[model samples]
Target: MRTSIVFLSALATSVMGANSTTYTLPAGFNVGLVDSSERSAWCSAQRNTCPDICQDGTRLNSCDSNTLDFSCVCADGSTPDVTPFKQTVPFFVCQANYGQCINSHPDDAEGQRTCKKNAVCGSKNATEEADSSSSSTTTAASTTLAMATSTDSTASQTSSVAAASATTSNPAVALGGDMTKYSTGFMAGLMFVAARMIL
Candidate 1:
C-alpha cells in the first residue's frame, strides 16, 4: 500500500509538471480581469470568433462564448504607446479569449491582422533584450556542461548546443507556438497510462 501511494504521488507530480507551462503576455499589453458581460460583448464584436482569434498560444481560459468566468482583456480597452508609435492607437484589441493584442487592420488583404505568438507589441528595452540573450546563453552553457564529459559526450553536446541555438533564434520554436496541442494530447495520454497503472 505504501509503495502504491508513493508511485501514485510521483505520477501525479509528473502529470501536473507536464501541464505546468504558463502563458506570458507579450510586451506592450496589460491584462485586466473583465466580467463575463464585457467579454461577451467583445466576443460578439469579433463575430464570435474568439477561439480563432485567440489561438496564438496565449489564451488562459477556454474559448467558449458562453463562459461566465472573468477573462483577460486589454487594460482600459487599448494598448497605448506601442513601440515605434508615440501615440495611443485604437486599432489593436485584446483577444477576448486571451489577453494578447490583435492588430485589426481593415485595409489588409485578409481584413484581419494577426500578430505572431509571443510577439512584442511595444518597444522592448535594451535591458530586457540583454536579459533574454544572456538567459539563452546560460541555458546553452549549462546544457553543454551536463551533456559533455569526454570526447563522445563532446560530439553530442555540440549537436545539442547547435539545436538549442537554432531554437533560440527561431521565434516560433522559442515561443512554443506549435507545441500546445501536442503537449495537451501527450499529457492526456500520460494521465490515462498513469490511471491504468494505478488501478
Candidate 2:
C-alpha cells in the first residue's frame, strides 16, 4: 500500500507539471480589428496596407499616446509617412481617400476642366459652391470639421488641427475603421486542452 500511494502521487505531479506548461505565443498573438479609440490595440482590419503595424498576435509597433491608437512606426532607415496623410495640407480644403484630392466644382464650373488628369481640383470653399449634387460633399466637409472639433472648446481646436494633419498624412489613418473583428484564440485553446484531458 505504501508503494502504491507513492506511485500515484508521483504520477499526479507529473501530469500536473505537463498541464502547467505555459504556451508562449508569438508577439501580437491575437487576430482582430482594433477600435480607433483603443490606444494600445492594433488595427488589423487594414492588414494589407498596415501589415507591419500589427503583428499576427496583435503586437503593435508603437502607441499614439496622444490619440491612444496603435501606430506602426517604420523600421530603421524606413520612412513612416508612406501614406499621403503624412503630407501637410490645408485644413479647410476637401480631400478624397488618401489625399486623392476630390475635385469639388462650383455649380457654374460643371464639366469645366479645372483639374489635370489624375489631379482633383474642387471649390476652395464647400459651403459656397454646394448644390443638390454637391450636398454630400458639403456634408462630408462639415462632418470632417465637426469631428475634428468635437472635443471641448479648447481641445476642439487642437483636435481639428490633428484631423487635418492626419488627412494630409494618410487617408487610411484618418478614415478610421468601419468594422470590428474579435479573436477567440484563447477560448479555443482552452477547449482543446479540456478535450484532451477528458479523452
TM-score of each: 0.18, 0.19
Candidate 1, residues 46-145, lDDT tens digits: the string is 3323222232222322223343222222223321122221111111232432243344443553433344443333333433444577789999998887
Of the candidates shown, which would achieve the greatest lDDT relative to the real structure? 1
Model 1 per-residue lDDT at 61: 24
Tens-place lDDT digits, model 2, residues 37-153: 432222222222333321122222333322323333333323233132211111101122112222233343432343323333222322222244367778899998887677466
Model 2 — TM-score against the truth?
Answer: 0.19
- The number of clashing residue pairs in model 2 is 13
Question: Which candidate tops TM-score?
Answer: 2
**Candidate 1 lDDT trough over 10 residues, lowest sum:** 83-92
Compared with the true structure, all predictions reach lDDT values of: 0.42, 0.36
Q: List the residue pairs that clash in candidate 1.
A: none
List clash counts for every candidate, in order: 0, 13
TM-score between model 1 and native: 0.18
